[model samples]
Target: MAINFRKGIDSSLDGVTKLVFGAAWDRKAAKQSGFARKLALKSGGKINLGGGQKDIDLDLALILYRDGEPKRIVIGHNMDPVHGAAVHSGDNQTGEGDGDDETITLNLTSLPAWVTEWAVAVFAYKLGTNFDQAQNVSLNVYDASNQGSAVLLDELMPTLGAGATASIIASGKINRDATGNPIDGWTTTLVDKAGRLGSQGDDTAVLAFAKQNAGI
Candidate 1:
């Protein structure tokens, strides 16, 4: 599929069963002060915020909703499996590598029937970290079941710069039709909003965004 994401536009997930969602970035070298380092440590101590390079850490999560109400969040911080191992998160604290820094896998068939909508979100987790401090930041979706011939289903690349100060972003959403059949019931929409809803740190923002998006 020639997947192109436009804000607020939805793409079909016709025959896709399992998917891999990837978030990637490369950190830029920068000077960190003592206070900054302390702050980074205070916020979970997930990375070393030294003076050499600014540790740009990005997080990927899924906010699940049932009947337009936020129910659960599948996050990487604690590595908890949701919906009977239907969704799993791969957390990366450092943007040290080439490709995707963090990933989340979703098995649509394993999801519970109550799950009506799911929101895809990524955010800058480390203190003082923003999209501007990273290079080649992007979120990608791939057909995981098609291992040998995996196809790129969709992608969302956040623009980096001055306006990229937003710590969190609502990347996209996967909504299912309760009354329809499995394959034709699910639809994925690209939200691509950077902190436009809220940025209250530990996912309060993403939760609120999901609820609002669901009109609840």
Candidate 2:
């Protein structure tokens, strides 16, 4: 069975497991459900929340950090970072796709030595209603080898209050042994800091809070 990471919860990640972050919704739901407006949740990584934006776009972001410092970031506007360690499949405004509307791929094994923690966040752009008003909204962590199989957090994402536009639902930290020796992998958890981030345009705000809440 897929592991469920309930709201306000956290879980550890296995080093050997390669993972991907994804999210999607049914655009048609807006028309049929009588709620019409643009809404989507972006799933991306954050190396340094307090750092600066390398580039800006409506798509998801992925970042790497070392010693709590920002290292590399990749977004739709700029998909040329981390070489081949990370890849973003662009944006999905309409949620008409079969599976995930947006996605980010990460190869933990390929991460550099100085890398520390990684975080994923979501934001609502031009929202018509609160998250609760959205239809079929979900974020998930799937296996790289089996994209169809979700290992963690493959369920409905809770909606926030009206006017809230951003959220950092989850994050993972690079693990270290009890002796302070570096381990091959890290653990993940549900930071659930939603409604704190601002509109999609204010992505920088989400980045800053991600560091403290995500523990990455």
Candidate 3:
């Protein structure tokens, strides 16, 4: 869908912040940092998997906001995440068709008094085979505040073919939507490499919309 930001509210907040939370695939002795802990705590703690093919599952959460005010937003849980609004409890292994994902939202006008920044967390799990050495995963934030849904911030894609498990966290700004209208929010796009593992990879690209952007 196209988001036009020509009409709507824009954020006067400062520049965006990006944080990558995950262990390096080669860091075997690395310990869990505060980023990982925060995700676990925010997502009710612990990572759960379902039954299906053995594949790596990545858990992600994006916190949106304006001039420090938190905005209500959701991510893809199953296919669409934003529109699907799929909320499944517990994690699933085996890479089953069932989707085990999480969503996040902030009250744009009522952000936490102590929160000075926004955060995006992600967890990457290797199910059957490891990721391709030439492939990289990226997290994209779209300006869902308008009609065009433009991309506000995108993290540098990660290379997950190092033969290790890990997670990552990054921060971004809530820019105007695709049409240039500023609704004070944004969405997420999870990008994977070529193929996943066994099955032709499917190389799914999930797009999540911000609830506050629906009006635009």
Candidate 4:
């Protein structure tokens, strides 16, 4: 609906950071069960193992809902600046199960009731200089249901260099069927480049739905 930015007061990070563009939700909902579970399958299917030029990685998550049901979906992956490979870490599928637990958590009870659905995404960029690279990323949100898992913005692809930032934009409002299940009505786009990239260019398409709905 509306977006606003303010100075960050929390000590989480030094220097001024943007705050509360609107009603913000945690990375997760109940911490027990929610949209996090729906993303496990997708997460497992998108890991990239092939080696290539080093680049920044971007992680993303989306929250969508209808009639007070919250759903969470996550997009984690790496980008090779030189080789131009957009590798996706895949969907977390389910909440932290065993092994490498890489899911973001958030509290939802504190949010306003009108906030029916929300989404969060995290990025783990520039894992390491060589093998055994680690992804550094986190993003999540709260809502009523986790029905937005079917929609994917785009396939992860390489950008340009380490200096450039990987950006993704999703636009469109959540549409539901007679049963309130999430239907497709939005479009998503992913973009890579050098220097700070805004919601523009070929990348602008990534956020088509986000721009129309959440205005992210």
Best by lDDT: 1
Task: Report clash pairs, candidate 1.
Answer: none
What's the distance in Å from true for residue 195, model 1?
1.5
User: Candidate 2 lDDT, tens digit per residue, 1-216?
Assistant: 244466545455553357777766554222321121211112233222322212112235665666675556555554557766677787655556477777888777776666677766656543343454345656667766454654653654745455555556666677566554566546666666666444344435545555655555
Each prediction's whole-model lDDT (CA): 0.64, 0.57, 0.34, 0.28
lDDT of 1: 0.64
Q: What digit string (tens of lDDT, one per residue) describes model 1 on residues 63-164?
A: 777767787878776455474544555677778977778777777777776776677666665456666677777877888766685567766776544535
lDDT, residue 95, candidate 2: 53
TM-score of 4: 0.23
Query: Candidate 4 local accuracy as lDDT?
Result: 0.28
User: Per-residue CA lDDT of candidate 4, range 163-183, in tens?
Assistant: 333322222133456654435
Q: What's the TM-score of every candidate structure?
A: 0.72, 0.66, 0.32, 0.23
Error of 1 at 30 (Å): 1.5
Q: How big is the positional error of residue 210 in model 3, measured in Å on the Cα after superposition?
A: 24
Q: Supply the TM-score for candidate 1.
A: 0.72
Clashes of each: 0, 8, 63, 44
Give per-model CA RMSD. Answer: 7.6, 11.9, 17.4, 20.0
